[model samples]
Target: MRDFFEVRDVHVMRSGAHGPLPVLGGVDLRVGRGELVCVVGPSGCGKSTLLGVVAGLLRPARGRVLLAGRDVTGTPAHTAYMPQQDLLFAWHTVLDGVALGLRVQRVGRREARARARDVLAEFGLEAFADARPDELSGGMRQRAALARTVLQGRDVVLLDEPFGALDALTRLDAQRWLAATWRAHRWTGLLVTHDVGEAVTLGDRVLRLSGRPAVVAQEVAVDEPRPRTPGVPDERVVRTVLAGLGVVPDERAPDEREPDERAPGLPVRLP
Candidate 1:
């Protein structure tokens, strides 16, 4: 059966000052319907680039991006992308911000605001409806941004470190909220994050990318139940993903190391 989402041997390059710089090297990935897939890689390994390609914001040098078995390369209609930054417009109220997508879709301002209010209440941000982006806490801002994304009603949501900027406690809160929200509305998701525990806790499967011009180094399936408690990822899953990323040293004896076995390449270390 065809996957709900597919990235087939995708390759991307950008023109650098010196010349062409390769970012993604023959990348292939897929996410089944309603599956949340987390991607971890060293910084500058083109994680965001991959999401951009999937989001149809960037055209791949080679390969195809398909949603629901139809090619959607360079067409963003199939996906909703939320970047690392909240990117909320300060002038827009929380309600207006969340309603932006609907408004863009030609929803009447009154109707958009009404729908936005409904989602805001669902997101527990109704009280902050009139708040500016600067007035809300980091977590609240992200929630507002997410509410906006969710309002797009897209089946695929691409998240690039959505909670990376929050404080540890706030991050945890955001994770719990996100997990619960995702569970209730099971959109196929691809999250790009450096947090191993986050990946383990939130993703149905975690894919690790390594080396410059990265490729998938490993894929770890997380068997834990959803709406997972924040901060405490399944220990075994965490260890497996951490080990794959070289965040944790292997316990093998020195003599057992094969000459052909290469060390894991990590772009960034996770806490």
Candidate 2:
């Protein structure tokens, strides 16, 4: 596949009380047009930091971030980001907050809200449109924030654990919604998640990062059909990601993992 986004040898450092701490060490990855790539790594392994770099929230100490062949390193203009938290304003109504992205884009308020309402209706948040963030449930808040992120009209959307805050059941619902929306819109996404299942369910390919001072350790193609059955799609793929994170499944787990079989679609590179 042709590359739509590229992070080449990107490195980052964060200032700590003692000194500068190296976070990402020569990280590199690429995504094709309209593809969703999910990143998984241990907690505090710079997974989010990597997304921040691509989102233009942090300028890499070295290397560059390119989108559609243009260097957008350290620039937030071309991308839309939805962080871990919903980040909806307490004062702004759902309609207002969802329209924020368009507003910043210079779309007229009336027109922005009209567009926002259309998306809210589509996302099943129309009933809560005029309600404040605090009034909505966790899932609703996430949907609202997602609406804002996507309304920006950027081809790429950076998601940092977008469903992390919700409870298990709610998270599953959000995952389904996100998958369907992605299929419909065909937008490019780079999502970071601690949940391997989430990564497996949502990504066309799952990328695993090494420990701190992170880099791409491995990439597994999720060859399963779309809208996968979230948590139980494929144990072997889950095993592969877990292995990268140094995790081993229970010896007596119901399905005894085969010793030599690789995941069904051995290697997948979008074309």
Candidate 3:
């Protein structure tokens, strides 16, 4: 695959309770043009940190970020990044919030809101265009945030648990919507998700990272078609990701296997 967006040997260190803490250790990632790739790893791993570096929000200690083969380290304008939170300003109207990116691009506020209102309709938020974020539902807020990111017209998009804050049902709904939206936009995406199913459903490939200053441990190709329904992750691909994260279900019958093995949401460890 052509490396449209690449992170090479990235190393990140953040101030922690105990001096500088290593977050990413020699992480390398490559995504083809317009490919949606999912990244999964142990909790507290450098997943979010990796996205920060790739988005140019945080400069890596030792590595380079490339977009279409152009080095763009410490340049935040190259990509549109939607972090874990919806992060909609409560004071700004839905239209204004969605228009923030365009305004940042030097588009006049009047023209930006005009464009934002049009996009809000696409997200089914036209009726609430004048409403504040507090007046909108969680799903609606997320949609507005996404519309804003997409309006930036960046070729690369980074999503950090975009649906993690939503409830299960809402998350499922958001996932479905995002999949369809992504299919339509076809922007190159790098999403950090803990749900193996979400990764399989949305990603063309899944990368598993090991913890303690994370590093890529395995890469699992997802051969499924796009616009896949959310909540129904492919067993084949999910198992591959989980197994890569060192999670294995006991084949023995329930009577013989350990209870934890039979339980749902088994804790997967990274070695």
Candidate 4:
């Protein structure tokens, strides 16, 4: 209904053993209430850096992050962050791990556990509530991670390659689950993904980032319907990104030549 997350001319510069480097350069972006936006880019692009800035893990040298008309730059707990790894403790049971967020937020013990159980059930992880993180499959662990985030009940979610570690089939399955979950909950989500298919499948709008000093190269709407079909979504958007990256020739014009099968480290790994 309103602008839930906004990044205006955001910039992140880092200085370590290496010289000063700009990871994000005047990046301008917005995620409206209940909107799902996906970010895709090359390997060295700063998609994750942008997420870190939004999550308040990294401070921007310039610009700001706004949540619900309030500035959250360098502030914690304004939004929930889900990193590439699930980060579930191996020793903790599924419910326990999920409840950790609520507990940290000082939600009452009884109330937090109840809400955690309910959220897990909603995600179809109720059966494994008592199981340890190691006992669950990859998808289930990610589900638990999401459950934890939802329990915090934050308005904006910064998802950093949440499904990167799963197998192809598992990743697809998780994508569907994530799409369904997003539809059901309708939280404003910003996801950073290297996989173009993942971006197309889950995003209402997709943004592509160029190399270092990452800037938005292109933003494409995913016109496909939600609850995406396996290959269909990939086919629709992957070709577009491939063309943008010059891996595939533009089909808009008549060209007898096919896409270069040998674009180094392209998303689909063409045969």
By lDDT, the best candidate is: 1
Listed in order, each prediction's TM-score against the native is 0.91, 0.90, 0.89, 0.89
Winner by TM-score: 1
Show pairs that collide, candidate 4.
none
For residues 1-271, could you state the per-residue lDDT of candidate 2 as single tens digits?
7999999889899999999999988888899999999999888989888888888889999999998899999988888999999988899999999999999999999999999999999889999988999999899899889889988899799999999889999999899889878988999999999899889889999987777787777788889887687666577678777765668743433364333223432222222
Query: Which lDDT values do the candidates have, in the order given?
Result: 0.86, 0.85, 0.84, 0.81
Q: What is the lDDT of residue 199 in candidate 4?
A: 83
The per-prediction tally of clashing pairs is 1, 1, 0, 0
Per-residue C-alpha lDDT of model 1 across residues 1-271, encoded as one tens digit per residue: 2369888888898899999998888887888998899999788899999999999999999999988888888999888899999989989999999999888889999999999999999999999999899999999999999999988898799999999999999999999888888988988899999999999989998888876687776777798876688899998878766766678875656565433223444232211
lDDT of 3 by residue, 220-265 (tens): 7788776587888888778656755668753446785334345534
For 10-87, candidate 4 gives per-residue lDDT tens digits of 888878587998888778777889999999888978889988888898889999988878898989687889999999
lDDT of 2 at 107: 97
- Superior by lDDT: candidate 3 or candidate 4: 3
Q: How do these models rank on lDDT, best leading? A: 1, 2, 3, 4
TM-score of 1: 0.91
